[model samples]
Target: MSQNTFDGVRTAIIANKVDGIVREMTNTLLRSARSAVINSARDFSCAILTDDDQLLTAAEGIPVHVFGAQLQAQALRAAHPDMREGDAYLDNNPYVGNSHAADHTILVPVFVDGEHLFTAVTKAHQADVGNSIPTTYHAAAKDVYEEGAVIFPTVKVQTNYENVDDVIRMCRTRIRVPSQWYGDFLAELGAARVAERRLKELVAKYGVETIRQFVTDWLDYSETVMAKAIESLPAATLRNTGRHDAFDPFLPDGLDFGVRIDIKPDQGRIDVDLTENGPNVDCGLNLTEATTRAAVFGGVFNAIPARVPKNSGAFRRVVVEMNEGSAVGKPKFPHSCSVATTNVTDRLINCVGAAFAQLGEPYGVAEGAVGVGAGYAVLSGRDRRTDEDFVNQLCITANGGPGSAYADGWVTYGVPCVSGLMYRDSVEIDEIKMPIRYKHLRMVPDTSGAGKYRGAPSFEFAYTPTADPISVIYPCDGQIAPSKGVAGGEDGARAAAWLEDADGTRSQLPNTVAMVLQSGQTVHGFDASGGGYGPPLQRDPRLVLEDVLEGWETAEHATATYGVEFIDTPDGLAVDDAATERRRS
Candidate 1:
């Protein structure tokens, strides 16, 4: 074979091997992960990076994890200039380049022919990290110390592939689930080792010089592709603003956030400015810089075609600007950022897209569900059955809302924030481990925002604790405020969660986690739907009739909202187009 052919073959094999390595890492972590969130929901990320800290490839993982791991590696290399062959580092401090304290990152240096070539990392989200509260998501936290666990950057947890039992002991003593934390830590270490072995094999087969050239060439090619894609977008500046209910006790005045995006086609760059946003509050909604960047990447990546390779080169075409104290840009140390990173990130992405919509570049989409559902529950006193503290972060899925597109109705029950990556564990599986009984779990009827392309439907879940004493904590918003529609679409319904007791008493669930439930009492949670795009009046009459028949829309609602006239025929429902047009007019 010619030299070019050999290089091409070697590149393809290395890339394919990297992909397989990530898949295997995911499988290994899932098999060993003890929590339902990791093993069942798979809320973790695995990736490979060059020694210079460029993200090469990542397996299917959360946006926060993939982005956080990349940033973490860059920070690790900077913090420890003398990184050695046997050294491995662990970090979760939001201030030191992590999504948040709950997301622990493990990094290991890969070597070939006695030369350090790259690093392997695995980022995993822990359900509990020894916080003062039952769950690490403390909406009331005022500072980093109150936010539970905080791991420093470049903290060597292992040397020469040997376990650093001291660090392990410290972490195990702090977290609620020791066995699970230890298991996950081991899984991360195992994942790193897997990547190292695969990388070494590739180097051996292709030779060191060939592998190095491929990495450099691939990164440059990726950068050019991304730059060209950005340059194709029409040059323009777009601005959007969104607000979440300020239920936090510290931010009694209410909190609001705004975004400004400037797309410069001449420079092939998109600049995100969040300087005019709200100041960081004492509440947990504050987002660290690392978390903010992750959210930005999520929105940008989603707008781009899916086939595009993700690397540092892709980011070179984009620039993000935020004030030092802005909520979305800079987060104060020790603030609870768990929810803000996901919820606020979703809002920022939508705002960016909405701004880009005016550029006429087809670079934007309609809003979808952006809130994070906190399925928190606590069991009071020791469980007589297990003789241990009873605490669990109930498995909650981020339900899908409507997505904006020119064709077809919005995706019903789709993931709004991170898209269709994470899913809810089965109700049976949830009940088996937790002390809750799920009575209802389905899409709420007629909750979609009505429009030419209707928004996705919201969901309603009802559950009651079966154990002697259990408390529920619901950190949800969109009750006093509803997700707004884009263009001419109608607003989505508000989300609400409340407790219904046997005595017919009821009360609203607070945004902060607190003791709010008991045995024999039921709690109902309703998620908000995404906003629709376009005018509802433009919807096809036949589609309206079908929606009514399918139970997604009510007959009366279709007639009133969309001005659709339907008649009952022998076969089924039929649309009266003439009447519908007359009613619409």
Candidate 2:
């Protein structure tokens, strides 16, 4: 074989090995982690990076977390100019590269042949971060300082293969759950070390020079794949508008957001300009630069499903420009970003997806809007059952996925940022751990966006606190501005939260609030579904009957929206083909 062919084969093998190593690292974290958020929800990410902190490959996790790994590494390198072996740094400050304070990151420098060659990084969402509220997302906080989360900006937590006692002591004193935090810290450390060992094994098998050459070739190949994908798209600029719920006290009516995507096929590049987006408001719903970039990249990856290697190389073909003071851009320091990963981030991601839908045909389809935001709840009080102090954040709100051309949207399939693997808290596990009783947990009816391909039905449920009144941290959206459908498809259902008193009275909850739930009072919530593709009238009559039979869509909704007539037949509920055609026509 020619030299190029040999190198290509070698590069492919090395890339696959590297990906496996990162996957192993992720698995190690999942297995070793103590917090339910990390282990149960799988809200952590692992990655291998060049010593200079360039993108390599990341294990499957939340897209935002994986993309932020580079920033975490850069922070470590900046803080310690001399990053010696056995040094491990931790940080969760958004200003310092983390998407939010909850995602504490661990950065370990990897050395091969006594020369620093790579950095193994892991970002995991900890249970608590000493925030003003017990939860990480303090939506009501006026500023970062008020949020009161311990902002570890490039702090070395370990040195010379030993834990830093002072740092650990400081964290222990500030957070409510010191043991859980420390245990998770160790888990992240373990994952990073796992990556280091795996990298060394690769280096030992193939000389350092050969491995380095493979990295270069792999990145080049990824760039070519991404360029070709962009080049294939028809030369068109698509501008899409979206919105966030009214949470900002300053703006009683909420805000309007917009994204202008300029696709230059000839240049093999697409520019996602968020400069025209709404101004940064006085709330915690703003997106950090890292979060913004991750959102844009999430859209690009969603648009290009081809086997384009996910690294710095593929990202180079997509240009994301954001206004410094915009909600989806660099916010001035002190603006509360505790809830930055969701809210505006989700809106931006949906906006990007909508823009791609404008491309049409193979390049695009009807817009399938992602969920408005993640549902967040903080349960803080003594666990009467265990007789222990407990404060935990419930991060599992199935942000219902949007429908696509290929298939129907999945019910409770995490947001675009998360790779659909972020698991919801097991209902049995939640009841066992927290003082809460699950009254109901199931999909709601008529919640799916209507079209030929319907979006997944939204999840709705109710629960009552069994112990002392616990603070309910509710940070969500999609109520005022529900997920819109593309082309002629119908819009999806809105997300909502409320408390029902024993007397059957109800009090609606705001988009972002830290409230209390009294005993005997039940809290209810619903995750908004995504928009569907194509017109509802064009949907298959058989699919409509199935939806009605499954109770996901009401008989009235099937008839009114899909123009399908379901008749009770001897076999069961059957679609009346003649009546359906007449109604559809």
Candidate 3:
């Protein structure tokens, strides 16, 4: 347990080993999970924590999920102070430290001999949690009680490595898709076990004291790296405001969110003030204190250099303050936060990112209309192929990303709080699993935020139900307050959703609503585009020509937006330098 025994080389190796443990845990869950959301889309995270609940290491996954893993473990221990070996806990209540009700965490206590050593945690987005609706994003819920899923707050789900029958019975009876739900539950459990086993192996190999010392050294190293990075940033105090479209009926005018950040490199602290933010409303969009902290950490960690490890040490220099009743801070009991982790979390991070950009920080990106998945649609029906029930929420990877200063945004950047590593479900998989068929799926033309470096283009698609009737729940964002660009960048296109009936009649589905799709009915949607960075005229003409050639931007659209001229050539399309110069002049 001596500091002299752990050198820089040994510390780095130990850190990698800890990271590998979580990676193996994630792989175990992905392999065992049954739902497409977890198996294919990979909406889960794994983290190893110290006995006292400090984050030691984590797998690369959802930024919010990984960031909140520490909080989740702390909550677990706080609720169950008598936790022992073979004890497992489950919690999805945002108020109790989870990101949202749908993001359930499985915590397993690791013990070496008779001493408590570490905790292995796995958090995943369950498609359904015995909610009133089938989707995790329940935008229409008026209150927490009506949000559908029953909140399990640090409850003992397992004891002595055996399942608790009452918990299993409740989940099985409450959920519409019990088979899928139980399968996912077991997968989470399996992931926790994998981490527990790996941690024990590490202890067996390096002795508990030595492994503990390595953790201490590794955390200190991460702190030093982050401190250096923070000291190098420009010292400034910035105040910025951003808006998010609130689907809650109480906030028809939308929500006004604000941030005041003071970057003091000398003190190695970035103080964020959220007192000026809007108050809580009557919807599932409310954010808990833990979620707010996760969002703020996400912004800081993302804008910093990649050398800093996202552990307890990296957050030492950042301070965040929020009003108790604010939408982005503390939430009272029974305030619905079912959809709190998506659009609202994005808005907070967007505000912080914009503030950093105003300070001339090189790592800041243009405001991304992140969380395009906030407006996800959930479809549920009895599959005729197997005569079994099915429920699914479209993965956010179907949407495009927001623009950045250095490059155009990536297509389907996942959500704001993710690492942009999530995979979108394939059309073939959808047809085979669900009772629906895709009629068309392609990127929309001219929807990218037009700028020197354009944001990624959005997509539009249509799908028809393969059965006589199927229920659908629409929870979407970016319709009213789309993603905005930084500097001279342009705003991306707004999103749209509607259903075309068999009789050729069309009806628009509100951002938050539930309806039924009949046989021969087709659902159509247009995803929002990312905000542009810099000015359109500053874009390279050759890149504009490439955009036109790729059909992402029409010739006329390119000329109007980028002040670039494109001419038809035998090779397809060529930039007209002469005409482009004239337009620029």
Candidate 4:
């Protein structure tokens, strides 16, 4: 192959092939994993990295999980310089480049003809990480010691294509539900190995020389594409600030946040600066290096066109600056980042995405609902039905997504961190797997942020334990400052979770909740709705009428919020066009 040869067609084909490889890995892991979080909720990611530890491909992977994979791959190389053909590493150390402890990552380096070529990667959030509480999101943990989850800093878990028995034995000893964890572990490792085998096949089909050349050219082409996307936008240097609801005793007034985004349109560069931030407190709300970087990238990528490849090639143009000691910037040593993947991370994403509104119309998104609500609770106990211990992070109802200039919010949006990629599990599966029964799950009316592009409405869920007592824990957010609309839209509602005992005694739960529900007790929760995108008055009368017919809003609500009137005709309710126009004026 000539160095001058640049076949765009071949490059495209190879790109598709590599992307398919990643998707295959994802499908395998999801289908084979034993944990509900992996198989049902799909809280996992897969990717392929270059020999030099640069992110090569992460097609359709969750934004937060895959964006910072290169950093962990780099750490693996640093820890194990003497790399071999048949070895895999596990990384979950926040300080050493991970989003948090619960996201156990497996890395397998691909080799061909005595040369290192690529690495297959898979990252999955564990259902139970051996924390002080049943939940992995330990929002109140004061430090790493209090968090009480094992941490791996790019440690070897496999060698010579065999499981390291010591590492497996240790994990089985510590984690609750040893068999369940081991099964998931095998599935995740198998996914990576599948990618490794696929890479070798590609090498055999296409000569090594041509494949290597494709990597170089493909990366360069990806850079140009991203550069062009940024060039299409207006240059800006914008600053935005937001606050998290106070967690009593530690942050009474709550934690305040600030972000600066500088866009050099001509140069095709964007700089996200988080140096001017508050110091890390003792709680698990502090951001790890991985979460800080991923949050910024997630917000920026959402701001730009979705076509921009989320790989190291395109990432070269964007610069992220973080302070070591700041809560939202990077991890402070020994400070708990147990809840790093969510909580404050969600708020920062909203602030950064909303900052783009400074560029004016159609440039920014309204704030989305933040937090892993009670609907996504961590439930645990011995399953009386099966006489075995069980634990799972149920993905029942997702938080509402923010409305955009082009579309309304996604109804099943899990959280801002997930980018709405994780699926909400089926209710039937929950009943089959755990000893619990859902009472009622319905959408809350009059909770959406009314606008031309209306936000997603809040959802309320009610459930009761059927057999034995169950521990329920959730680290929720967005109660204090419910998602606020941008571009003159109305603000959305707040979230709440509470328990009703058998005797009808009610208790309002705090933001970070951990309690037990007796067999007769019920858990009721409502996740906040997302913010609207544009002025409510600008909404079309026809859409408003449809909303009334669908019972998403009453005719009176439509009149009050959208200035649309309705009449009871012989056949059905119809929009009173004349009255609507008169009321608008």
Candidate 5:
């Protein structure tokens, strides 16, 4: 075979092997993980990196984990100058290079033929990391110390496959669920071992030098491709701003979150500066450095072409700057940043995408779900039936708004920042885990952003407390403020929630989780919709009629909101072309 043929074969084999390694890693973690977050929701990521710490490939997991680990890898090498073959490090400190303290990362260096080849890393999000509150993301806290747990960099947890009892004991003691924590840690180790064996096999088949060279070449090629893509984009600086409700317990006054992006075409780089953001609060909305980086990368990647391979190479041309004490960027230590990942990070990405839209037409996707939608229900007090330690369960529901697109209206159930991601947990599962019953769950009709291409509709879910008295927490934004539209498209509808009782009494709901519900009371949640793109009047009459018949748009809505007339025919809905043309004129 020719040299080119040999290189092609080797690359193909390595790619397949790397892909298999990640699949096995996620499968192993899912099978063995103790918590629902890991096993059921699959809130974890696995990746293979070169020995020098360049990310090669990662399975479809959390965006933050994928990019955050790349930063962590570089930080690890810098922090641990004397990293050996048998040494494994465990880290979760956001300051060092992580999204937050709760996101524990386990990394082990892979060696073959007495030579360091790559590193296998598994990053998992734990429900609780021994925070001040039951959930690691406490919205009421002020500083990082109040947030929950913090693990520093270069914490050696394993040596030559031996269990580090000290580290294990410390983690087990700190977290609420020790059994789950231990199980996740073991699964991470198992994943690393699996990668190690596969990597060694590749080294045995192909020479170690050849494998190393391939890694270098692959990363270099990826970087070149990313840089070239950046160069192709129009040169311009775009600015956008977004906001989130302040959740500071000490400071009840609301605050604003902002972002500004500067794109440099000549240098083929995108620089994101968050220095003009809101002041730091004692709330959990504050972000750490690692979380900020992850959010920025997520926004950039989402706006760019999806064919681009995600790796450290892709981020090589991007530079992000944030104030050390700002709400959107890095925050001072000991600040509660539990909600940063869900709330602040999300807004950051939206703001960046909004900025990108100004550069040209069809630049980025519109905003989707903005808030964390954390509905925490804690059951205390003694149970009349069992009389055991009345179990208190805290759960979060996935509520998403529609996202706007260039050609079509916003996508319903579309995830922003991270595409193709969904939060899973049905009412049946919630009932089995806790004492709750869902009364009504369905999509909210006519609650989408109205435009030529209409935004996707939002969803609504109503649940009643069945077993014991429970506290319901709802953290959301875009209620008073609607998602902004680009071009001439209209903005999305404002979000709202309420509590309805069987006694025909209804009360407004707060964004916080302080309200307690009785056994018969029901809580209702309404998710917001995404902003629309382009002018509503420009919408096709035929498409408007189709939407009316499909129930996405009512006949009245088509006439009023979209300025398109529709007639109900015997066969189906038909567009009134004369009326539509007159309305447009």
Candidate 6:
């Protein structure tokens, strides 16, 4: 297969056909997965990778999981030269290519006749990954031994579409929830198989040579699109630093991350230097190779136009430099990357976006909310209905998105990693599955960062357990350092968590928590809002009045923060022209 051979129309048709196959894989996983986090929250990703290290998600991929997909594919092929049809492999070793041990990924080789063409990948976050503490994000774990999740390094799980009983038995014996694990495993396998079947069908319809040409043409096209986008930018070099809150007794002063970007418009390349970041600590917050690579590119892709295809061709435009054993670089083996998917990864991404803001107007967004709080905490307990054990993370609450150049931040924007892709779990499903009851979930007033186009407001969530007790674990951050605004915007509120007793006594909890919740006690969490984009004084008065009317902002906040005076009319709060003018001046 060579370049400039296939017609554009034929390339598009074949590309759509292949992408549709990937969608089928996504649907299979979503519908068949067993865990609440998977079937309900949609904490999984499906993608197809070329045998030659190019990743093709079309648009169906998670930033964290699929960013360094080539690494996993490389490891898979290197480990097994005997790869063939009807065979499957599992790789969850962060030390290898996986983002973290909690994500159980299934890889199946898509074979056309006897030639292996594509690999179907389905990565899903498990309810429990056999960790020592039951929770997946073991921020306290000093190393891999303390993390305790079984590390599978590209092990063959199936041959000729038949299960390896020994491997299955090993997982069943080690994991906490055997039946649930098996179900999720089957769901991932089913997704890969579905992709394999669909891909094979596509190849047969178009022939292998035609499909190969499409791959080549698509990659070239994507590269040209990204190159053109980069060439349009005014060349500039920017340096920025982002910080993570202290780990209390361990890192009292916290960690600082330094990022330098050299935008080369002539060469159509953006060079990101992460060599100046802090060294890796003993905690689980250290990043694996997969996550470290993904976080940087994810941010670069985000700062650019949405039309640029996020394939390997586009990825080649950005050159990344990482120092060995650095905190945001490559981690040595045995370092606990349990919380690799988020934590520092989120900050690194925000740093890249914020750095691009130096290029001036409409280039980048303000730093969005960072870290996972109690709202997305991992919960484990006995289900009274089924008389069985249960452990799953909730996805009911999310951090607000940062304000952009054109519009206000999205209210339901999740953590920077997910980018509003994950599904918000149904309260009814939570109540039915686990012995838990929801108290309330709502947005707090006057909590969003104020600017011309304001950021989204902070949200609060509260819940209680019906059982005697349930273990709750969360690696909460973003308390001391709130999401900072760019282009003269304001900062959002800090995150906070509290436990209210049956007698209505409330006690503040730390950012990082691993506690057991009593039956009557309720847990409440208020996540921070995102940063604003421009000066609030420049904001439209009508938008400020709308916020006051909607209760997302109060009249006092509008007058003080946004400098918009509101007068109560029979209809609602309307902007007062004279008072607003005076307030603004």
Q: Which pairs clash in model 3?
A: 131-148, 131-149, 132-148, 375-475, 375-476
Q: Write the per-residue lDDT of candidate 3 for residues 345-450, one digit (tens) a residue.
A: 8877766775666654255666665544322567788888898888977663456666666678787775566636677777787677788888887887788988
Q: List the residue pairs that clash in candidate 2.
A: none
Candidate 6 lDDT tens digits, 429-476: 888877899999998999998888888989999999986699999988
Candidate 5 lDDT, 1-585, residue by residue in tens = 224524656566676777788888878887887666666556678888887777788867667677767678888888876776777889887776677776788888887766777889888777667766565556777667666575657588988778788988988887665776788788887887787888788788877878876776666666776788788788877777787664536545666666667777778788888888765777777777777887888788766644566777777878887788777777776666666566667777767776676764557656655544534333333344544322233333433443344455434343353443434554565565456678776766677776656667766777876767765544566565566666676677666678888796998766666566788888777766766666788777877777777777778877888878766679766777888889888
- TM for every model, in the order presented, reads 0.92, 0.95, 0.95, 0.97, 0.89, 0.98
- How much does candidate 2 score in TM-score? 0.95
- Positional deviation of residue 554's Cα in model 4 after best superposition, in angstroms: 2.2
Encode model 1's per-residue lDDT on 1-585: one tens digit a residue: 124434556566666777898888888887887776677667678888888888887857666667656678878878887777777889887766787777788888888767889898888777677767766566667776676665656688988778788888898888776886788788888877877888888789878888888887666666666778887777777778877766757666556778777778788788888888877777677787877777776667655433556766677677888776768886765555755546566666666655554553245555666545544333233355566654555555445465454643344333344555665666776666566678887776677887777777777778877776665544555665566666777777767777888787888776555774677788877777776666889887877777888888899988889998888789878998788989999
Candidate number that wins on lDDT, 5 or 6:
6
Q: Cα lDDT of all candidates, in order? A: 0.70, 0.78, 0.79, 0.87, 0.69, 0.86
Ranking of candidates on TM-score, top first: 6, 4, 2, 3, 1, 5
Better lDDT candidate (1, 6): 6
lDDT of 4 at 26: 94
State residue 162's C-alpha deviation in candidate 2, in Å. 0.9
**Model 1, runs deviating above 4 Å:** 1-16, 304-307, 334-338, 374-383, 406-417, 541-546
Q: Score residue 190 of candidate 3 by CA lDDT.
A: 95
Misplaced by over 4 Å in model 6 are 1-6, 569-571
What is the RMSD of candidate 1? Answer: 3.1
Q: If the candidates were sorted by their lDDT against the true structure, best first, what order would they fall in?
A: 4, 6, 3, 2, 1, 5
Residues forming the 10-long window of minimal summed lDDT in candidate 5 = 388-397
lDDT of 4 by residue, 1-585 (tens): 234788889999999999999999999999999998899889999999999988889998987888889999999999998888899998899887889999999999999987889999999999988888888888788999899999989889999999999998999999998898999899999999999999999999998998998888788777888888888889989999878888776566788989999999899888989989988988888988888888888888766754877888888888999899889987877999988888788888888888886676777888888867788889999898899988999888867788777787887777889978998887888888888999999888778888888888889998999979999988888888888788877777788988888898888878877888889999988988888888898888998888777767778788999999888899898888899999888
